[model samples]
Target: MPVNVYRNESLVQMETYEAEPARVDELVEQVRAKWSLLREHGYAGDYPIEVLRGNRNGGNIKVVEVFRWKSVQDRINAQTDPDYVALAGQISSLTTAEGTKETYTQAVRGFNHNFPSVGGVELLKGVCSCLLTIDGVVKDYQMSVKNGIVLMHRSPRMDLDGDGRNEMYLKILMHGGEIIQAALGPIRVEQNFNRPNDGIVKSNSAGGSDFPGTAIWRVSWKIHTPMGPVLTDPDQPLIFGPATVNHYPPVGTHFHSPTGPVALVHEETGARVGTLTPGELTAFDIVVTKDDEIYADVLNTPPADIFEVMEEWRNRMGDQEVQPVVAGATDGVM
Candidate 1:
C-alpha cells in the first residue's frame, strides 16, 4: 500500500505502511502534530527545523529554532519577581542603606534641577550620526533620566545579528543620540531607530533649517509626551503651556511629583489623564529598552501602586498577587 502525506501545502494523506513498532510510533506522533502546527502559526523566525535520521548523506535531524532569542538578561529577568511595584517605586523614605544613599542624593540633586540639557548640537549629532551608522562602533556609552525614559547606557559593538545590535541597552532616550541600544550583554536590536527614520543624516547637523529634509533629526524625548506629540508631527499641535519643552501638561500642573514617581497626562487619551494624589504612579507610556530589549509592554504594574516599594518587597517575600509583567514580550503575543 502507498503512503505519502504532505500537509499545509496540501496532499493531506495517503498511507498504507504496516510494519508495526506501534505503527511507527503512531506515525511519529502524526508528524509531530503537523510540525507543531507548522511551528505555531506557520513560520516566523524562519528556516530551522531538522529531524532527519541517517541514510541520505548521513542524516540525523533535530535542529529547531523557528524563533528563539530572549536574553538581555533573559528579557531583564522578565520582571525580576517581587511584584516589581513600578520597579519598587524607586523611593527613598530613607529607611536604611544610608537612607538609600541619602535618598539617592536628594533624588539626584532634585532631578538635576529640572534635567534637560543635552544640547551642543544634541550631543555631537548623537556621536557622529547615530553612533557611527547604527552601532558599528562607539566605545562604551551612557546617559540617564529615569521615569521619563532617556537611558542609553549599556553598550558594546558588532551586531552579529542579535537584534538590539549586541544586547540590552535601551535607547530612544534621544535628543540626538539617534536610536541606539544596539548591543550590550546578551543581544538585542529589534527594529531599532524608534525615531529619526526619515532620511537619517546630520553631517554634524545642517545648520538647522530643514536641510536634507529637516536635517539634524533624532527623537524620543519621549517625543514630548502624549505619545510624544502624537508620534511627532502627526500634523502638529502639542501645545502645553509655559513654553513647553518638558515641563509637561495643562500648564505646569502644579509641580508634578506625587511624593515619588511623576504623573499627569491627557496628551490624547493615553489615559490616566491626571494624578498628583494617591502617591502617584502613572505609566501611560515610558520607553526604555535593555534588560533584554523587547519594547511594548504597556500595562501590568499594579502591586499596590507602590507603597514603599510594596513594603520593601513585602518584607522580602513578594506577593499580594504579584504583577508588573510586560517588558515588551515580543514572542507569541504576551
Candidate 2:
C-alpha cells in the first residue's frame, strides 16, 4: 500500500498601528471585527491570530496583530477580496500612518523551544476511547497515554485465530511535533520529518506479520505533550494563544469522519465493522504499517448516549452553570 505525505507552507504576518488615546478601545474592537470578517470570508490563517494593545510613551495606544497566512495564494487573495478590503479600510481610518508597519516571516526549523517542566518530569497525556474488534467480537477501549506515547493492548489474552496466544497490540509515539512511530502487533513504521531524510526511518521494526481482518477502531484522543497539544479534530487547529472558533474546513484535504455511520468490510474474510448511528463527528487518521497491518484512529460517538452524558454532567454540577468572576476584591464584577 502506498502512503500519503501532506505538507503546507505558511507565512506569519505582523502588523502594528498607533491609535489616539480616546479611540484606543474602538480601534481595537474594529481590528478584531476586521479579523473576524476575514475569517468568516475564509481568508484567515492556519494558526492563531493575535490582536494586542499596549500603551505608548505619549499615551497613544499601540496595537499589534499577528497571524499566519494559509498560503501565498491566500495572502494574495485577501488583498483583492472585497470583504477584507472593506474591513481593512475601516481599520486604516482609525490608525496613525506614522507608526504603521507590516512584515511577513517564515519559521526556522531544526530548533526546539524550552518548555516548562513539572516535577522534573515532562508528562504527556492523551485520553481517548476506541471500539475495537477481534475475530468479529467487538469491545470498547478507553485508551491512556504516558510520556507522549499511547499504548493499546487486549487483556486476558485470547487466541482469536487459534494461534495459541493473544496478539493484539498497538503503540503510537508523538513526542515531537509529528507522528514518529506507530506499531501494530509485530509490525511497525517510523519517520522523522524534521530530518533531511523525510522518508520512513524504519518501515518494519519487527519481522513482518500477517494481516489482521476487519479491525474496527473508533478512537478519539487529545494528546498534550511537550511539543504541543495534538488534536484529532481538523476543525480545531493548534494555537499558542487564544483561539477563535473556526467552522471552516481544515488546512488541506485530509480524510475526516462524516455526519453519519461508516462501515468497513474485509474482502477476503467477509467480516465487517458494525455501522454507527448518526451523532457527533470526529477526525479520522488511518495508519497502515509496512506489513499491511491497519489502524484506523476514527472516533464516533453514538447519538443515543449523547443526552445521557449531558444529564450526568448536569447532575454532578447541581444543574447550575459555572461562571467566572474577577480574581479578588471585585465585588462579583467580571
Candidate 3:
C-alpha cells in the first residue's frame, strides 16, 4: 500500500449508481474491482477509494463510488483503455442508466488530512478568492476576511453523508459568528483567504474628522491567542504604535515587545511567532508584504511602564491585564 498523502493533481470524481435490486451484490463487488484495477494501473490516487452502499427507492440499491485520479491525463487514459472500458460497460449494465450521475471536483488544502489538534490556524499559502469553481461550474459562495483573521476548528468525527465511513471535519469560523464547515473528503474544499490583491482585498472601515467626541468607542478589544482569549481594558483604549512604512527596501516591519513578558501570535493563522519572558523585549517581526494583524498577550502582571490594569475591573476580577498588539503595521510590495 502506498503511503497516505494528498495527490498533487487534486482532481476527484464521484460516481453514483442506482443498481437493480437483483444485481446489488454483484454491482458492489464490481465497483471494488474497478477501483483495484485503477490503482494497479497508476490511475488512482494513494488515498482509499470509497464504495458506499445504500437503499434507494423501491428497495433498489444505491452505490456511490468516490476516488481521486492520479492526474488529468490518467483520467483521460482510463476513458479509452480496453480493460477500463469493459469494466465501465459492465457497471453501466448493472445500474439504471437514467439514475446514473457523475461529478468532478478539485480539492483544496485540509481535505483528506487530519490536523493534530482541534483548533489552530492555517494561513492561505496562495491566492484563492471567495468564488469557488469545480469542473467549469461557478459556485455561488463568498467568504471574505477583514483584518486577515480566519478562525478554524475541527468537528467531531461522524458519518455526515451516511457513506458508511466517518469523515473528518474542518470548520472555518467567519465574521459575525458564521461558520463554513467541510468534510475531509474528495469533493470538499477548504476556503482560504490569504491574498492581498487589489480586487479581492477590501476595506469596509470608514472614518472622518467629524466633530465626534474622542472617547466615542471604548469597547474592549478581544483577541484570541494560542494561550487563550485575551481581553483588553474597556476604559483604556488599546494603544497602537505608529506604522512603519516599508517602500524602498520592501521588507516587513521589525517589531519589539514591551519591557515585560508576553506572547506574540499571528492574527491570520494563530501561529505563535515568539514568546517573551520578564526583561525580554524582542518578540517577532511582521513578515507580510501587505497589511495584516498581529496580537500580543501579556502573560503575567508587569510594571506600570509597560501596561497597567484597570482600577475597577482589576479590583473585582483580579490580575487579568492582557496588553493589546504591540505592532499593527502595513508594508508595500514591489
Candidate 4:
C-alpha cells in the first residue's frame, strides 16, 4: 500500500523521521540523495530548505526536513510518485519508527546581515530606546539624528545573562549627562520592530559647571502573569557620570546579573560600545534625576490583555444605556 501524505494550501512541508542510533547517518545520506531524484522528476521543487538532526531519548535519532515546494499540489504529487516510493522504502528500512509530515504556511522570512545577497549589502538601520526610572520617576530617550548622523547601534538578540530567553541591546554616546536606566521588555506584540534592550548601560565624562547632555533611554516590558506593572528599584539609576568640556570620555555602564555580565552596543551600527565588567555597586550609588527630561512614554501593559480592557469599556457603555443603531438608518434617525 502507498504511504499516506498530508495536503494543505501552504507551499512548505516538514517531514520528520525517527531512526536507530547506528542507522541515523545512513538515513540522512539516503534522504539527501533522494532529493536530487525528486527534483529531477519534478516530484519535488528544490532541495530541502532546512534539515535538522538530533538525538532523542532511548538513543534514537530524529531528522526533520523542511521542504519549500513550488506549490502545494507538487508536494502532494511527489509523495506518491514511483521514484519517491522507492526512495522512501529504502529510507524506511533504516528506521525503527514511522515518519511524520506537517505542512505550514509561510508568514514572513528574511535573511540576516551576513547572508550573501545580490548587491553585497546588508540592512543596518534599527531603532533603540532607553527607559529611566528613579525614585518613582520615569524618563525616556530615543536614538535620533545628531549633526546629520545617527548615533545609535542595535545588537542582535542575545542571552547576555544566560537566561535562555534572548534579549536585544542598544548602545549610544552622549555628552556629559545623567539619567536612570530601567529594566524593560518589548511592548509590541510583533517584536520585529521594537525589541527589549535589557541590561544596557551608558556612561559620560565630567565637565565644569555645564549641563551635560543627558542620555534619556526607555524600554518596554510586560510580565508573563497578570501582575500589574511593578517597579522594583524605583530610586536607583543604573549608571551616572559627570560632564566634560570639549571631551567625551569613554565612560560606560555595566551590570553584573546573577547569571553573567551584560554589555551595551550601538543602536544603528551594532558595534560594541562598552564592556560589562563584573563589579560591585550598591543601590545607593544610583540616582533619579528628573521626569521632565523624558522624550517619549511607552506603556508596559501587554497587548494580549486588551480584551479585558475592552470588556470593562463595554460594561461602562451598557451602564450608560447606550443604544445600538438599526441597520440602514439615516443620520440621527436611528
RMSD of each: 26.6, 22.8, 20.5, 23.4
Score every model by TM-score.
0.18, 0.36, 0.33, 0.31
Supply the global lDDT for candidate 3: 0.38
- Model 4 bad stretches (over 4 Å): 1-9, 109-334
> Candidates' lDDT values, in order?
0.22, 0.36, 0.38, 0.37
State the TM-score for model 3: 0.33
Quote the lDDT for 195 in model 3.
Answer: 14
- The list of candidate 2 runs beyond 4 A from truth reads 1-10, 98-101, 109-116, 119-334
In TM-score terms, candidate 1 sits at 0.18
Superior candidate under lDDT, 3 versus 4: 3
Q: Which sections of candidate 3 miss by over 4 Å?
A: 1-10, 98-101, 108-334
Superior candidate under TM-score, 1 versus 4: 4
The full ranking of all candidates by lDDT, starting with the best, is: 3, 4, 2, 1
lDDT of 3 by residue, 1-334 (tens): 1122232334677888887788989999988989899999889876578888888667777888888888888988988888998998888888876445465453322321221212223322221112211111222223222333333232233333343433223233331112231311112222222311000000111232111111000111233432343322222332211112222110122211122323433345555443222110110111222211322122111223221222232243333332322321321110
Kindly list the per-residue Cα lDDT of model 4 for residues 264-325, writing each as its tens digit.
33344444332221122111110111122322212211232222332343344443422211
Q: After superposition, how far is residue 219 of candidate 3 from its true place, in Å?
A: 42
lDDT value for candidate 1? 0.22
Per-residue CA lDDT of candidate 2, range 86-175, in tens? 878887888877445565443422211111111011122222212222223322221222122222221111232343322222222232
Name the better of 2 and 4 by TM-score. 2
